[model samples]
Target: MKIKLEESTFGLLLASLLLIFGGVFSSAVQYDYTAVIDCLADPLKPQYNGGIIINPEINDGVKGWTTHGGVKIEQRSSISGNKYMVAHNRKQPYASVSHKVLLEKDKLYTFSAWIQVAGKNTTVTALFKTGDGFEKVGAVEAQVGCWSMFKGGISVASSTPAELYFESNDTSVDIWVDSVSLQPFTNEEWRSHQEQSIQKVRKSNMRLQVVDQNGRPIPNANITIQQNRLRFPLGASINQNIVRNTAYQNWFTQRFTVTTFENEMKWYTTENTQGREDYSAADSMLAFTSQHRISVRGHNIFWDDPQYQPWWVKNLSPQSLGPATDKRLNSVVSRYRGRVIAWDVNNENLHFNFYESKLGGGITNKFFQRTRQLDRRAMLFMNDYNTIEDGRDSTSSPSKYIAKLRQLQASLGANSVIGIGLEGHFHTVNIAYVRSALDTLAATRMPIWITELDVQAGPSQAAYFEQILREVHAHPGIQGIVIWGPWSQNGQCYQMCLVDPSFRNLAPGNVLDKLIHEWGGATAQATTNDNGYIDVSLFHGDYEAKFVPQGGRVDEVSPQGKSLSFAVDHNSSGQVIKFVSHV
Candidate 1:
């Protein structure tokens, strides 16, 4: 017989039936297993053999590879399974080995190999033929003795077929290349590889507190921990007045986290190469940075570029260059020893060797050693340009620059050069090339700073600026970036300045401003609750907290009742902070 039952009673009866035959009922539960099964399985990345080259090992002797200019099969030391190809410079400028491959549009390909230098420093560059010319994908400096593995990637923009090749240059060195491989990486794989190489440097959390002179908690403190990364000195640069200009200063103050006195601290500008010092401009620049509580980078202790050198330095006899260098370095470094955090010991040593040409190559070693001796506190940097912006073939490619640093490190005992300064002066940028260069230099394990980063004024300047800034921020190896200017001479316009002459933000400057504010560093108001304490977290930087005391009746003379302003910097961890409000 059918029994009439309420909805609740019927559900209970159904649950009871299911419980009595759990295994039978479970089969009818109905579940989607596709996503779960896929999650449990490993990801697949397909590799096509003989797609790019056959017998890449070259053990069978350059069978499928074509030689360009002076390349041959060599029995030299092998990187992997034995046998390799050697590109002999033999006093010539360049030699290369190449293989042709048909690539699809929009696919990403990476070409990698193990290479070693038989003689002097060897530079290996990855290239692809483009409509206009050969495009350089990556370059690396292989050491003379050991095998170094290097790889570079390319994003195919068009469906056109191109020959992918590895070329070695430098009259002084011969290169042995082995185990060449060309393969396509999935988006996930490429991103994962990039993420793995990126250094993990998390943003620091700053803990802050406010208290009165009697050590009592000061409730209702208005805290402004405005983190101007420009002020924090993240993408910092040398400037005389952006920190002080009314129309432009706000953009600079709110955006940049650091400052550098570009011309004020130069040897020629400071001493005029006559040994007479002018501390006024430099002092002002330092004071401005100090008042803002931003870090400062010393532009240069010595710059030996021939055309830019002081007239007196040029006239100095070969023997006098040494003494002049010593005097200049000692005088400048001693003045700003503890104040400046980093010093460009000798600017553009990679591009120019005026001092080296005259005082001998050993002079650069002496320059670093001497700088370290006097200014033992600061990070001494060997500043140069084109290391990242120019391709591997340029005089200042990452591979060549690293080799130069290695030479300096070998002679100066390692500690002499503590930082690598990359002058990121670019007109056009290839993100892949820049990333590859930085990755190669990161192998040095030294802190890398974008010393003179600026994009030229152009239609795409703003877009390029944002792209590069994001790239730099994403890279773990990049410690900080120092931009070139707020404006160039005569207001003609230059790359990297945030504001125009009218104090209006250029597109890039606006981008800079938006980034700084979006980081959301400071809390406008954090009132203390009934417990008479307010705990807040901030970005790792300096802060100013204004404490407004309550409870006392307001007087006509002091309506706010004696508000106290305290300048404090937040440490890594949020700690119980006691601020002495009254003296």
Candidate 2:
């Protein structure tokens, strides 16, 4: 007898059977299927060494390895018989052990390794030397005594022979490496993996059973399931134009269920004169969103960039700036306390520190504490740019972001509610690096939101936009996404616009609509089997289900048919809804 089950259940059952049979089924699986199992698993010490790198674990004493820039290289073993490669006696920062590998064009290669420094902590970057120039794969802050996992990837336009190596600016420390891996995947394979992830993360399996009022099984019953609202917050940014223009309102309301006011809620716009404040524009915008039942994310309470601050506030002394900021925070958070769902408490603190440099080093912590006091229910976020967009900006790298988060958490206590807010403004999308960065930040287990996601204007803008949206949506760590594109009277936007001046759909807008429709659970019809059960897969959201008897009309609101509502969110599991029929 053959039985159908979910992939996870099947895997567990297969593993149990293998354990009982004692190696009978082990040899049948020859190829590495670990990628299919968990695509985001640690690249270092992967289940299979399928790449071109020889003796990746240094098991064969540095075989197929050579020195770069005349650096001394050797293989060493720990007391536990674990082997690793080390580059020492380096005269140049780029001097390290290297391996030559053939890379195919248009293939995405993800590289990872366990790296450590012999001395103090320093940044180590993985590089690929191709015909064009040196392409940076990824980087990690390597420290002494412990190993850090370095991850990054590159996609080439042309097939070429490339040399892979590691570089650290501090030439005084030796770069220790182990458990290296370089995995390549085609674009099609990458998309397939994304679909697989969406199935596992964003969807759930439901089994609905039909029965009579007397609890008897009723087969051949008609069932209908329709999505009411999507729980996943996929939205776009909006300016004050949405409050006035009917076309803008209709365009936005039809597509997004969540939004962030472009500049209406910012300090410079709200309190430009410092002493006098105006929230009429913001208030009107909030009212419109509230009437439409759309959720709003508080764009920010305070901006850390000096350039973004009000002219009057920037020149004030540290003592005066402290009280003014206090007043600003209290005014904003208290007014929109329960209105907003999440707050970017300190905006762009990782890049600039206007408040920190002027008010004091501990001003950011105080701002968060004050915001929490004002709105304890809302999630606080450290919203910043380039954290995942670019790998070169170590200032807002995932590691540095986490470090800053820890500092804030340490001051706020153990149970503080803080979130990772990545402002994803991209010129060119780096798929592997984005995934790796999210994986690194997911270790904190805090809620993460792509607060300001936008791809710059280019021929590949729409394609890159779709790629980024799919990648983030497929990842389980991301909670929500808000595009940075805000529509205006003119056909202009921050970097990318979804619609033209007529409020018609552009290329990116079409992609957005396509995904929105695809992810939604449009009305589906099915019939119960012999056991009076109808099995179906549904996306995570609120849904409405209806049932009708064998000879009953589904359109009629009579005793022959019944309707019910249920939610398919992260908490939903093994859901079985039984509907009682009057027939």
Candidate 3:
């Protein structure tokens, strides 16, 4: 029989039905709802702790490990759980202890350890098995001194077992290690952490504007903003006419964020390019660059290229070599102590060593020590080339580079060598190899800079250049990039020029412009939305915001001025700056 049910009874009946079949109904609803939360867990995210390397803390007295060349366990209360491993090598150049660990294919693994050096420097090397042989995944050098943390990692290209070894090059020092760890992380997690590290330390920002006494928006004004202390140096080499040529100057200011005087600042150019210390050009260049707020990189205090050394010093005997080295370092570094950002103390030590032969092996240490003393603020770098090129298995391989750095650290202490400069002169690049090289160098916890990056001129030059720049920018370990090619009129540059001398963008230049303005970082432009407000996202740095009367015009001469200038900062949130146009 058909019977009418009251509203309350029907509601109760529906509630009862929902209680009984809620699970199925909920699933059906979720299937139809497009905005539902993803119920699946991310597989890339590690679900468990990575495989353990036995005796990582040396808690078991070096058990579950192969000891080679005077490896022993030390009991120290300061260390975790009061125990650590010490590899003391006094006779031979090699001493190490390694623990084998299994790693997954196509996964990123990071290996780290707490290390202390007593006499000289030591290194932690990671090796993986490949068809060819044991390929070095990465190596990290520990500075000689008190306990320091060093780390390195690799993305396993295949399913292979890896070994983490701590090696002391010689009997020069006692290497101590503890708290070793091999951990796996997803790319997303790694990049998220890196972003945290990058933004953890905030710099103060300034918000400025130029206008008349009355508040008005000045649009399309010529503006220049210079950073006081450059943590990142995105720059390019300036042409010979940088100071005089309008095109060159405009291109330098608009495109490059950092400045490297092409030939004017080099040792040969400054001291003896003309067989005399005619720094007239260099002095003028430095002044103009400084005024424009472009940080300069001391290309070289001394050039080791045998064909490029000054004639007077080339014939100098061993006795006078040290003094000549000191004079040159003192003269160049002392003059621009606070002005230039970093000094390429000895250029390409890996490629040549004229000074080493004449002044002995101590020249590098002395150069660093003297540069440190003269300009304590500027970083001292040993610049080199071919360190991260496609064919790296040859002489200037990453392993060879790591070994050289270890020797320098052993003699000069870790603080002496503050930066690693790689002249990224590329014909072709193996991106995987480049990433591996950067990972190995990052272990030292030093700033890794692409000091002279430029691709060879080719049909694919633009593509290759863009690819390299993207890779560098993607890496958190990389500090900055400085291109070493000029925008020559005839496209005959040292490498690939970014622009034509007519100030027109070439292919490479187009890619670079996109990276700088659209992808890498961005600038915001909009008229005040009734409230004289515009919002923009910027990487932490100094900025110059130009405002003018917006009517689709670049610039216009007002009774007061053509445009207004504003120096503004986005250091914190909720920042509102006012610019009263005096013009």
TM for every model, in the order presented, reads 0.72, 0.88, 0.60
- TM accuracy, model 1: 0.72
lDDT of 3 by residue, 431-451 (tens): 545655665566666788898
Poorest lDDT segment (10 consecutive residues) of candidate 1: 31-40
- Tens-place lDDT per residue, model 2, 494-533, is 8988989888888989888889887873588899999899
1 versus 3: better TM-score goes to: 1
Measured by TM-score, how close is model 3 to the native structure? 0.60
lDDT by residue (104-143, candidate 1, tens digit) is: 6645665555666767665667787755467777666666
TM-score for candidate 2:
0.88
Candidate 1, residue 547: the lDDT equals 50
| Per-model CA lDDT versus the true structure | 0.63, 0.80, 0.61
Steric collisions counted per model? 15, 0, 24
All candidates: CA RMSD (Å)? 12.9, 5.8, 13.4
| Stretches of candidate 1 exceeding 4 Å from the true structure | 1-95, 102-111, 117-121, 141-145, 169-175, 181-199, 204-232, 242-244, 414-417, 518-583
Better-scoring candidate (lDDT), 1 or 2 = 2
Residue 248 CA displacement from its true place in model 2, Å: 2.6
Least accurate 10 contiguous residues by lDDT in model 3: 27-36
Per TM-score, the best of the predicted structures is 2
